[model samples]
Target: MIGNGCWFEFDEVRGKIIIDGPMTTDLSFAAEEMQKYVRRAHGMFLPIQRGVLSESTQNAIVVRIMAERLATVEEDGFAITYRNGNVFIEGNGIRSVLYGTYRFLELYAGMRWLTPDHEVIYEPTDRKVWIEERHDRPDFRRRGIILEGVQSASYAIGVIDWMSKNGCDLLMMTIEFWDEHQAALRPEMQARQLRLGLGGHSLDRFLSPGDYFEVHPEWFAWYEGGRVAAQPCFSNQEGIAFLIGRIVDYCRQEPDMDTLSLFPNDNKYFCQCPSCSTQSFVSNYTTFLETVRDQLEADGQSVRIQMLAYNAQIEWTMLESMPEAASLDVMVACWGRDYRQTIGSPAGDRDERFRRIVADWGQACSQRYHSSLSVYEYYADYWMMTSLFPPLARTICKDIEEYRSMGVQEMICLLLPYEKSVRIMQEEIMGLPRENNLADREFNSETPVMWLNLYMFARKLWNSSLDEAGLIDEYCRAAFGQHGDTGKTLLYALEQQLAQLTVYNTRWFKLRYTDVWIRDHRSKGKAVVTGVSPWAKEEDEPEIPAERSEVSRRIVEELEDVWHKAAHQGAHSDESTLLYQALTQYFRYVIQKLRSIDKQSSAQSKLIRQETEEAMSDLTEALQIETEIRGWDALHFAHRLRDPNVL
Candidate 1:
């Protein structure tokens, strides 16, 4: 029953759907999305009419598009309602309508998109929806995730459209064959999206000796020896003008871009000339932005310029004055942070410096000028490359809240390269039998920690005041099943246990994880990688000691006990359960490594080897289950778990 107290049923019993506006490709896509869900609900697909509806048409879904001038809901916001016995989905624009369609299914039909393909849609026995009018918008304007490079995985998975439906409005990058693959996107995604350039550090590339340094060396930044094009001399009037011209030309080429990054070469080569020494870097940067702002305004363009205020370049002295037109947004980088503790907390911890730097930077961006602020976080690293889920929920959540408080409106959470964060572990030579229905969910088991964090990240973006325990509970229930509580207990326990490690003391947990990964890689000759979306690239491995094996031995025994006592273990083999066991197996190998180092007796070695083999067998089964569910291993690679250079 709707708010009007009338039952709303979308079955073959309803009238044909009608497009109430220009029947563009996006509208067609929206209609198709609605049609599929309708069929799933009633076992009958609804026919859609693009032409004028019949005079007598009744009880139909009408997708409406507002005029271009009146699109105040930004790009992706929408409104859904039931009126005059017909369902209506209206948007500020076509893309908004498409988002509305997805929202309808989510709120009224009990549909949850756990993954792009994996979903859980509850079938209503009565097939009746009680939808009060709902209008929704995002908390922030720039909501996005960078795929970095998985051109093949991106195409195969329909990642863009999935993002559109799931509240992502921006997709970054293009040099990686972007246009070539864009043809595969559905019409809705094509209509409502923006692609950002991460390679904004292009000043040197454009102002190089090969391009202009030879003609005018003064335009280039100076090192101890001489002028070079590696970085521009910010104080040089002519050079700033030249770089601005280059940026304008690039902007013309990519007119669809809304945010333009004016980042310089990613190095420490700033000008040391007498003129530069007289003033501050921030003041000089402000001058460059003022020039760009004035030029862009004259050109009648509203494109905004952003810069990376990174490292030594970010010293915070009082600005002489803010720019007349604060057209900049700084993307602050948080590097070498301690993942185990919140920024500024743990008083004497190394992260205190980071906390102070970010605080001062935030103030300068806000009080010092008209420029806005955003943050760039290394959400995933080398440690995250492994299957062990990093216990970073509390720390990251705290960061998000803190960033928001500091007036930062956007976050660019970058994960490392594909090899480290995109692949899963393989412990398979067998499959486990199940006795009941499984909790349905779609997740990248290979990147389980990141995958889990990805969802949490999205939630925090939408609502920063999150209940950590509640969020974990929902995630656990969705990713696992009846045993989710048990699994969550293990997850928290693991994170808490590892927090004690001096290894994870800093946000550089990635280095510590890599340390363990490479040491074990040599033990397992070659990894037989298969079963994933055909787009995933070949990916990377780690190990432990026999005296060390005692902890491993006990952990294996405990996990075994948990498995036996696990409620509804017959129902489904959960990811968390698999992850817990894999860690134990990896530790078992750790024990074996230590015993070998101690030169243990042959009899003792034999017993440890037997235990290792058993653990390996169990790991194989767990991995096989994971592969079956996630699917996308396009290449092969070694599992070398040793990298002395990483430490």
Candidate 2:
């Protein structure tokens, strides 16, 4: 019996189906949209019926309409059933329904839902969790990569779109001014301009309290006895109103937006203005939220607001005075320092750190606000070359468990820009088995693990307690298609190497006299040999006292060993592409250490510069060699050589 709240009921005898509801406008069209799925699943057309909106219709259905809040402002309305059935699914809107339908068909084809007796045993792990959905659809899923390396809305949308296919529910954009193009939101730029306001790069362009020196300068919050550039001048009513209006306008117009993330809350310390510096951190956010609320309300539309628990502002006292309105129709997107648990291991305990941070943040924020809180785990470390898979997965799992423990309900991954990482996450998400079983095998694939990782990462936004191993197996099969064993071997080795590297990667180094001397005196102030070669000479030299720099020597030596090990791992790997990239970086670091020791001779500097150039030339050749060997473009290496020293 499909007992009822909101149900997608089908009648084979009548050759018809009815989509019942308390559904959003998008979900209300589900019955009309079922044909796509029906065609895919049963390969036939069916008439459909939709129930009228009423208490009678709402109270007695097998499935119930529910809201799964997303990180974005968009509302993801869904259907849930406490009763068992032949099949169950959840989708974003039409697209999601189509996708869910396809998933249903895939499972059907595999007889994944049928039992030995040919009876359907279709029960969700929890009756309340039959289907979970996304809050919004990405406007332009793929933003072609930008050369300047600035993370753009277009770029993020591309990531969102890719992740969406794998099961990600929501995506965030850190919007600003520069994104609008050289022109304002004129009709010409409208076609090209992203939905969210552009992300501003220069700090001066951002509306900081200190930056508001010329016009409306009186609004600055010169509170508490200190002065700083970090806080925005919320006290400046005119300036505040102008910024708030812009944000509200952006939300109203941008079709891709489901939520508008207010980046101002990232302010670490409160403003030092004599009038308001002492205000609670949360109060600062609430002030902005209230100002935004006023503007949004006036615009005659409600938008979900997402605020950050960023920087030094992340404290319990801040949450105390958060405005009531901000709490309503709002969600928490917490990011500060890093998710400690995201970096798991003996040396780096990302899991333990996550537990502590999540508990503290969750309890503090939820106690004061009536909002859904999601933990954005930082999985990838871009400063160094590494895949965020292990730490990403490990941190995600820990967050799932901890958030569940804290009675908070959502988990989101703060991904860096990497197609490979996204792919791996997808597998992890879909590979999650039918129920929550941590002991189940991790999702792995023979091909590339990027998709699997993306899938799993997205799945966390839905139900965290799903099957672990089965999902992994499913994703592995999908990613590898045929070379299952090969995929598994590659994935295993990669995981092992990453696990080993995580230890050395997180080992922080304190600057030694040698490091300082190397950067300032030797090698023409270039830490890398490549950075130093441009200024090399055969006559002049800079002097440095060697014995006084024991700290610098030790630091250099330790870092050198770490790089050497990484280099060794790369050589050991059969993947020539990954191997050479790692080796290249390791060699650069090694050359830097060597150059650091010779701070005084033009002749020695010239030799070092010459060697560095040769090494760099070798790296370029290696990249080309690997590209030829693979008979393909060297995608990873293309960016590395853009700057052999700095970038």
lDDT: worst 10-residue window of model 2: 111-120
Per-model TM against the reference = 0.70, 0.53
Q: What RMSD value applies to candidate 1?
A: 10.2
**Residue 29 in candidate 2 has what lDDT?**
39
Question: How far is 611's C-alpha from truth in model 2 (Å)?
Answer: 12
lDDT of 2: 0.39
lDDT for each residue of candidate 2 in 149-233, tens digit (9 for 90 to 100): 2234454434433432333444443454234422332222222222232221222243554546555555544545434455556
List the candidate 2 regions with Cα displacement exceeding 4 Å: 1-103, 109-167, 176-213, 216-231, 249-257, 265-270, 280-282, 312-354, 380-395, 419-447, 499-647
Give a tens-digit lDDT track for model 1, residues 1-647. Answer: 12333456665765567788665534776788788876775567788878655656667887877544334355566766676667878886656787788778776666655545445553343466665776666565576665543436454245566566666565554333344454454233455543443344556544666768789999877777788666678888888788788766655665555665566555556677778766665566766766876787677777666666654322223212233334467777755554566664644544666676677667777786656677766564433333333546666677777777777777765544334233222212112233122212112232335545555666677567767778788766655555567657555544443333323313222132212222222223423212222101122210132332354345445544554555344323444444434333333332232222222212123323554444333334433433443311100101111221211
